[model samples]
Target: MTAVHASSESPSETRKFLVLLVGSIGVVYGDIGTSPLYAFREALRPFSDDGVQQQEVIGLISLMVWTLTIIVTFKYVLFLLRADNDGEGGTLSLLALLMKQTGSYMPILFFAGLIGSALFIGDAMITPALSVMSALEGMKLVTPAFTNYVLPLSAAVMVGLFAIQRKGTGAVAKFFGPITVVWFLAMAWGGLIHIGDDWTILQALNPINALWFITHAGWAGLIVLGAVFLTVTGAEALYADLGHFGRKPISVAWFMLVFPALALNYLGQGALVLGHPETIHSPFYLLYPDWALLPMVILATMATIIASQAVITGAFSLARQAVHLGFLPRLLITFTSETNTGQIYVPAVNILLFVGVIVLIFSFGNSESLATAYGISVTGAMVVTTLMSFQYLRSVWGWNTLAAAAVLLPLLVLESVFLAANLFKIHDGGWVPVLLALAIMVIMWTWTRGSRILREKTARNELPLESFIRSFEKSAHPPATVPGMAVFLTSHGDTTPAVLLHNIKHNHVLHQKNVILTVRTSDKPYVSDDHRATITPISDRFSKLELCFGFMEQPNVSKALAICKKRTELKFEIMNTSFYIGRRTLIADPNSDLPRWQDRLYIALSGLGIDPSDHFRLPANRVVEIGEQVAV
Candidate 1:
């Protein structure tokens, strides 16, 4: 029976893998696939101002090709993919894995993860503005008459994209893969036809030319190198989306399709510029004949829109992770798909990104200027990822220091160089991402610190759970007993919940069966059903229930309680159960450990947290909230 079952499922498994491969191409590769539209043009701009030189063109293209090889192909696809936390990847996931392995927090690693996450959010804001503008800019090549419409069109596209996010991506996701595949093929065809424009462009395949260009071009080369980094900007998405598609399909899509198409298109642009230096102004679009210009423009816009959508979705996922990990306050997370829990819409995040993108489009006015601001955040994120990966190599994989450094040091050096190059653009436009990242970092730091102080303060005054249970059991005159189950939710299971105490003081009665329930987020992406809930009996009337959810999961108290009934002696009907939650109204103290600004900020962030009843998916009618005032 087992063998027959395996045989019968083989084709179904194959189909699923193929589907994932295509999906990876569409989402994972979309941002990087569209880089050719602006990367080469911007890189060549500085040198081509006087006039384009063949050596300069080949050398720049060589640098771009090698940068992609090292940064995207080797570091991310081959190396970092293996460092995933359980089946999940991303900075926070890696941090969670590291914490689980070491069983302690390392401040350096914590800040690295925080910074990486902040930069990723910064990247999310900029990608939509940069990509859509770059695509719309192609209209200028079609007819200068369309030039005036570019900014408005880009803004409209961005607004429309965010406006429809509440509707979800499930219906349109099926088309993303096929459309992107066509985009890649079109890029390859354009490049293939132009390779004959100058076969000598093939010399760019050698890494020596890239090295020569860097050494000889001096300061200008560093500036151009900043532009070169654009080729690999979206490469991090490959690792960030690991949990969504898994490593195999992402790697397969890159090796089989994305890389070849990018290489061909880039080389074609280089050859075109070298053969007809006049085409340097708009080499990407000039690769095709005049008749194909408008169609390609429309296609490029669609491709950019897809890229923007991927990053927006990624931002939502990252924000959700931050909330689960306690770096941020609870957010209003709306499930957009019935079957796929990962398909979510965060209204707060969506509005933030939309506002940022609009500000960028209006401020920069075009992709060229926006490109100046782009590299810093991305390169900063890459540097942080590299640092975390080095730590992972040593700690999790048990590699010796020498072995780990040998693998990561060179990559770190390269990323550091990219970061340094991008830093030079700060005066021009790079300050945008830096400022955005700093603001987010401040928010995260304030929230985490304030939460800790509040936790410690609350713990100081609260009674121990065991002691309270024992005293109540030994009391000569106990409170009147109710006939239903009472579930009190608390963050610290060791302490008696304030809400439970309030209930005893006011209502003056205890349930026939009482449970002190605590929900915890696990280090792993998911916990198995068998390990999801644990119950410990304190007495016949009282028991302790702990529900463990993965950082990637939504915590549903009601559902977990259902699982508990089957796994343990706990039994209760939803209609007969009442969940008690503590609602703290925090007041900021000037003399608090945090500065006044942070105290106020913390209070503001606290106000943003969703109601516990809604967040835990508890039945509103069956839930009761007890209020208290706390100062921090």
Candidate 2:
């Protein structure tokens, strides 16, 4: 059941690239594209105390243009996208790549990745809340009468969005590209119409304007940077969805369409604000005409829904990666699309995010308030991405230390300033993402720590597979041999499985064909069919099977075994074979190395995972669980 999403053709293929480029626009650019709904208004809010000066508007526009160009276009699209892990990219994928290339499991690298991933989950929750609320708030422009309904309407839309996740994104995603294409076109048109009102706004393109604003506006302008950061909030999604669309298509979509559209929209908002000054309160929606207001609001809401859908799917994907990597406990995962392996639904994650987003909507009450909570986690994730990519550049790409530092120093400095700017916002509702990130980090740390302790415990007690075979060969009275094959499921490939030993000790019997099968999740996204399984023959009756799967894949022992049967000389019939699984009952030791609470926590968390049979897709009648109690 290992699921892998891959395109057989390269990104350079014209037909395929165009198709994926459209798909990338629908998915990858949704979050960033929808930012104009609230970003301009939020960034200019602090300037209201000073009566909305022209310099402030120009400077803010300049800041946004450069932020999108430097952060999204340069750092993410041009650079980090190229630093993918076996054609897959993300916080975890980047981590796996670093580990694979360097063969180093440094604690620094682990914590950096864990923190980045934790913040990503924070972004997952907040993005939907912010995007949906911002889009719905456009109704206020249609009529102030709609203001009272904005919060409830946003909540309802989000709840509906989460509810339909079980149905899969394949059906909804087909429409995403066309809808987003319309969104960008509308955005470009909206901006083009207003840019003519005040051509002076184009001067904001100079970085000097942004620098001048920051220096003169002082602390107030620094605070605005927090909001400006939102313009590129969805930049990471481009890398996360790399496997789905490929690199070239994403690059094309960004430069040719998304980037230009966003720039136009922002500049248009700046122009409108400068001309009327009063419209600074809602420059984004005001970019449209009186007749187009209702239509614009409808389109904006649809665009936000698409953005929310992308982040929700990303959360599911991230959760699956965490589970496969042993950083989190397994949850219920449903594959929504038969054709696309990447289209999966995680009910537990969806529910948690739904609750979090609903609470955010109800608590914040508007997109402006939620904007205060958004920028911190994104900037935090950006900082971590920069640090991790520094490692990739040096170790994986074989760049010299100076060269790597040269490439990363500017990004680190810029992100650090943004992070500090966001720090000032923590008391102003920024603590939401920070607290959420902390909780996720705890879960990940606990799972990783628990798994490590269990691995060490099992390794210490388990005998080697070769030794077991040798002892059986030298035994004075050999165990009675059954007629069919017995597949003992174990985590470690090099050692004897506990169930196999227990059966030999208690029942004094072994199957005619004994197969020691171990399933491993690789750091990459997909394992090729040819390299799926490695079979090592110990004896004619006893052989060892190692199954490798990518983190994004589902670990289906039955499916893998079938592939092994085809490629290797191993012989076994589905009906004739029996699967043995070891179920460990834990006894927490108070005097042990771990804290008592942690030991108890691990034991409690351990039971929350899916059943072994369900996880492996093994048949109920053919599987047997051998239970044994072990002290932690």
Q: List the residue pairs that clash in candidate 2.
A: 2-554
TM values, all candidates: 0.98, 0.96
- Model number with the top lDDT: 1
- Tens digits of per-residue lDDT for model 1, 1-632: 99999999999999999999999999999899889989999998788768877888889989999999999999999988888998899989999998877644488888998899999999999999998999899898877899899999999999899999999999999899999999999999999999999999999999999999989887889998889999998888998899999999999999999999999999999999888888987889999998998999999999999999999999999999999999999999998999988899999899999999999999999999999999999999999999988889888999998999999999999989989999999999999999999999999989999999999899898999999999998999899998999999999888899999999999999999999999999999999889999888898888888999999988988888888777777896899999999899999776799999999999999999999898899999999988999999
- Which lDDT values do the candidates have, in the order given? 0.92, 0.89
Q: Model 2: what TM-score?
A: 0.96
Best by TM-score: 1
Model 1 lDDT, full chain set: 0.92
Instruction: Report the lDDT of model 2 for residue 241.
Output: 95
Worst 10 contiguous positions by lDDT, candidate 2? 1-10
Error of 2 at 605 (Å): 2.0
